[model samples]
Target: MTKYQLFKKLPLFAYVNKIHVRYNPGGPNTETCRKLMLMLLDPKTFTKHPYLTFTYELLSFNERPEVFLTLVPQVPFRFHADTCTLDDIHRAIDADQYKAHCDYLKRRSIESKYVQEE
Candidate 1:
């Protein structure tokens, strides 16, 4: 199942099975964008497969981190900071809500392409 689908099923667990974090110094005053990616697995079936994958761009434009899903390569899927927060993740899964966000981005992406060609 895709990361989105899996996230909808599995209860949120902050314990990451695997993670990678990288920090790049922009300058003395410039805020560095820290990139992070982590994999969450179901405790009961930890050995089976990874459940959720979270990719975040922290300090984006010197602001809050932007969450993303890499369930599908080459597709940029964005999540609202408020909607996909750590608290929400721990509360309940809302695949349909986030799915709508993904759809909106997809449409915007496609529309931009057409506008560029016109």
Candidate 2:
């Protein structure tokens, strides 16, 4: 599948407050990280999560690449960009996002029921 197809509907992003990526433009192992940055910066991704904040840095050639995600609840997840593929990153984020979507649905249901009873 295409990278866009893989990341176009990440529900976890709805629950993400911010994302930060660090990579060295000249680093040999950072190609995937750079590609990820491009994907995250796509207009489709912005349309899907308009409120999401994204920031990135170009590190020195010797520095390691990394991606950081901050959830709405203030939890942080860190990934080593140099060691993983785009698919690996997608799978991890997808799993977390799916769970977050499920939790949001459950919370909405409970809130609605509570309101009805009151």
Candidate 3:
């Protein structure tokens, strides 16, 4: 299946809680994927805060087990590289926030639909 289709099947939380890579770092789609993750994962309530920055770190190959993306939240929270599906991540997140995110996506989707019909 196409990447977009796969992403649609996953929960909104998955976009933030996990890393979604389509190609290597310099590939055209790489930045798009990164931005998408940031948009969904943005910490601000109601809207995303543009002032927040997104960053990534790569450890030397000598480091232990495996390499994964680390999200440095202003506040502490649990994060991991486990291979859980979107539903799993959804269940793990705070209920109210999950609902808010879903609502945000729904509103955005409706807005896009209206734009397309215009």
Candidate whose TM-score is highest: 2
Per-residue CA lDDT of candidate 1, range 1-118, in tens? 6545553433332222322222223422212122123233225434553543433333444444334433222223344443254445333334543554465576679555434663
Please provide the root mean square deviation of candidate 2 (C-alpha atoms, Å).
Answer: 5.2
Candidate 3 lDDT, tens digit per residue, 1-118?
6545532343333334333333233333234344445554666622533333343543333332221322223212333322343344445554544454565577679565534663
User: Candidate 2 lDDT, tens digit per residue, 1-118?
Assistant: 6555553666545678788899988788888888878878789988888878989998987888998987765778898899987777667777667667777777679555434663
Model 2, residue pairs in steric clash:
12-97
* Residue runs of model 3 more than 4 Å from their true location after superposition: 1-52, 62-75, 96-118
Using TM-score as the measure, what is the rank order of every candidate, best first?
2, 3, 1
The Cα local distance difference test for each model comes to 0.37, 0.78, 0.39
Output the lDDT of residue 32, model 2.
81
For lDDT, the strongest prediction is 2
Cα shift from native, residue 87, model 2 (Å): 1.9
> Where is model 3 poorest over a 10-residue stretch in terms of lDDT?
66-75
